[model samples]
Target chain A: MLAIVVLLVIWWVAYWLKLQPPHLLPSPLDVWGTFTKLLTNGAVWEAVTKSLQRAFLGFAISVVLGTLLGLALAQFTLFRRAFGPLITGLQILPSIAWVPAAILWFSISTEAMLFVVILGATPSIANGLASGIAQMPSIYPRVGKMLGATGFDAIRFVILPAALPGYIAGLRQGWAFAWRSLMAAELIAYAPALGIGLGQVLQQGRELVDMPMVMTAIILILFVGILVELCIFAPLERYVLKQRGLAGAKR
Target chain B: MSESTIVPDSSPRAVAERSGLHVPESLIDAATAVSINRVSKSFGNDLNPDGSLRAPVLKEISLDVRQGEFVCLLGASGCGKSTLLNLIAGLDSPTQGTIETPGGRTALMFQESALFPWLTAGDNIKLALRLADVPKAEWNDEIERLLELVHLGGQGSKRIHELSGGMRQRVALARALAQRSKILLMDEPFAALDAITRDVLHEELSRIWQEQDLTIIFVTHNVREAVRLGQRVMLMSSRPGTFVRQWDVDVTGERRIEAPEIAALASEITTDLRREIRRHAK
Candidate 1:
């Protein structure tokens, strides 16, 4: 906590000294003022809620679809050989790149945002699950078989649990993709029903030429991203790692 | 050794007579626990239509384990002991002959603990119960019973990573037993442990084996381990694994590694194994 205070002091000093332009990077005081103004209006909160809802909805869909696809890809060699390359290729395409296609298909609505989010996230989720299944030790499945686990029972009792760590890792990566894609979709194409997210706030600030508000929006986006990671995914991942004894040491 | 010495006479009468009073002939006929008949396995394929001959891992191996008997397949490294165990477990098929396990289900324990990291120890055992079609009501009791059998009663809630190697293997043993299979195939289950822990587990395993009255086919490279636990030890040759010799051990009552007969039998088997390896070198 003291270290954080010291770092803030250093940042304040740098800002007072005008190390960079105020427009490109606003002073801490200016960002704080803008933050208070936005907070009072309740619009920022609404945007935040909207963004989170989209990200979570897309993430949930990706997890279910990716898990099913990954299982199919891992289990059926014919399916893997047929579509494995395509899945990987899909993952490499940028989420922002899907905006125009999604807009054309779903036509500027929450559906369009969801399509973008799923497009950006599903491949990673699928890949994570697939690799998890692939990396499981051969002995586990044999042990499963000897214990009379066959077909779906084999997958439920043996395969999924064995592959869970990797699958969880995939979900973490998928969330990142989902969040980023939702932001890009909102920024590029705004819908009245979709309302204003942080991405739109940044666009509005840019159009109004209010550099302080723009900087505030950018900082809030970064802050929200870090906050979600720290609050939700980081703790989740840590719990899993600690359970597996992969965490380095306990305090 | 002659072919007759290499393969045991698996005829029903011979097995019934050899298995002694405890194992009934009706059980032998009805419950020929595992039959590996002239099974040969080799990895890799040649470019030629006739197939390039990769050396065989197991060559014309035939063995029969009667119901409720403890048999150890003992051999050094590269002797294809694990391959044979895999064949019996149906994880892999033999290149030449078929293996018939009359018992519908078999359980296997590996050299490593092989517990799932994502699950608690009790959940791991419960998975076996779920697979075996045990009613959900019985799962809790059955899991506790298995944990008790392995002397790990309070460790059901522990994670695999939290347990020591010995404890993990104990949980693994419990999970395997939870299947309640008629036959249990173990591939060097204790080879990774320290001497003291291995000794303790040997006693634990013997006690469990007696209680369960389950047929066990254990594979190990450890000579003393073979002598210490097995009712009968079958030594295998290296490369193309074939039974080189058999020792019907009579050390019945609380035998230890230092027991005179055990040391003597281990020495004899070790010498036989060394000679077989030397013959291959020549």
Candidate 2:
């Protein structure tokens, strides 16, 4: 609620100052009008659904792949020695870098969007989990062994729980990457089959020179990011941190 | 709290008897729960420039911990009391000599509670039970029982941060006991607590130790704490840690920190420890 009010105040100030042309910066009222029209037409909801589906799918794939890879890297010396440098290098590369290859490989489909999202997100998740596993206190594994917690039980009960805070942090980073990658993919490859996403709407507004529509699309994208963080990732992160007593009761 | 209630069906006697049956001749021959035979530990593979082997942290340390005995390894900061405890717990290996512990497991409690922060107090105990392969049917009841043992019967659901410093250590004790191990290794577990809480814990520890009959090897730099807790106090010299002196404490019933014997023994150990530290300075 406070964010909305602040955004409105910024919009009013920008309009009063005549900052840029009307085609470049639309008034808050103009963006609201476009929002209402888009809402009534159901286009905003459709775009939101499509974007959410892609983001969630990409996130799921990243989590599974990242966790397994993280565990492998943490547990095996050979794997760590072989892939450690490559993994670090991969983290530095932006998701935008994969756009060309993703377009060629998956050809402007949902698969292409997912490919970029995974490429962007997996390294963060894997690194988070790997570092967390490494940081576990030395006493934990020894206690597990003394109690006969070998094989799967040791990994499941002891190792995983010990590393969970780090893993959750990684997942949060991965989600951000996935969200960004989805927007990038949608902008680059706008097609009917790919459906309408925020990026596609922004692109359409750009072509028609509809500044209010473009501002609406950009606002919607920002809104969606903040909403997801509050509704999904923030709560999840809070719960994990609270469980470990890392986050105080301020939330 | 009920005065006559037993914590769990898995009594300490039963655990002792079970381990007694499995005791190897090597361990039983020494009539001790742990027998360290000329054990020496050193870090790295390098020899000194003078063509002599590097000094060991523990040098040919031979010691025996009799069954159900409370032994304190008293020394200065670098005297390697903790190193010896680690070797005894099988977390590290001795460079030379042999340690014979009756095939039974040893539970160690660190200076920090070291409880799994993700788990609640009850769940932490449950994890120990789960790792020990206690039957699923018995876990819930056993957790409650263990909580009662530590005077935390209703605090099973409390998170680590919710508990006070002293309370967390008690829960840690309950978790360690949940393993049902024959030997318990404690490395300055109470050093971090306030003096009043430390006094309370000292009483709690003695009561629990007496009731449980656990073979404990406690490591501490505090001479008074050693005199107060251990049946026998073994003093180690610094630089290359070697046994400097040993004192058998004779305190009947519940011992007090203010008791003359306790003070006298502490002073004796302190004098010996001081001399050892002074020798290293030279």
Best by DockQ: 1
Model 2 misplaced regions, further than 4 Å: A1-27, A72-85, A133-155, B1-31, B48-53
Worst 10 residues of 2 chain B by lDDT: B1-10
Task: Show the colliding residue pairs in model 2.
Answer: none
Fnat by candidate, in order: 0.84, 0.69
User: For candidate 1, what's the RMSD?
Assistant: 3.6
Error of 1 at B141 (Å): 1.8
Model 2: how far residue A19 lies from native, Å: 7.4
Alpha-carbon shift of residue A18 in model 1 (angstroms): 7.8
Per-residue lDDT of B84 in model 2: 90
- Tens digits of per-residue lDDT, candidate 2, A12-114, equal 8988899888768878888889888987888889998989898889989999999988999899999999998898788888898898899898898888889
lDDT top scorer: 1
Write model 2 residue lDDT over B92-135, tens digit each, in one string.
89887888887367888888778888889999899898878799
DockQ of 2: 0.58
lDDT of 1 by residue, A124-226 (tens): 8999899999998887887777777789888887888778778888888888888889889988877566688877888888888887888777778888877
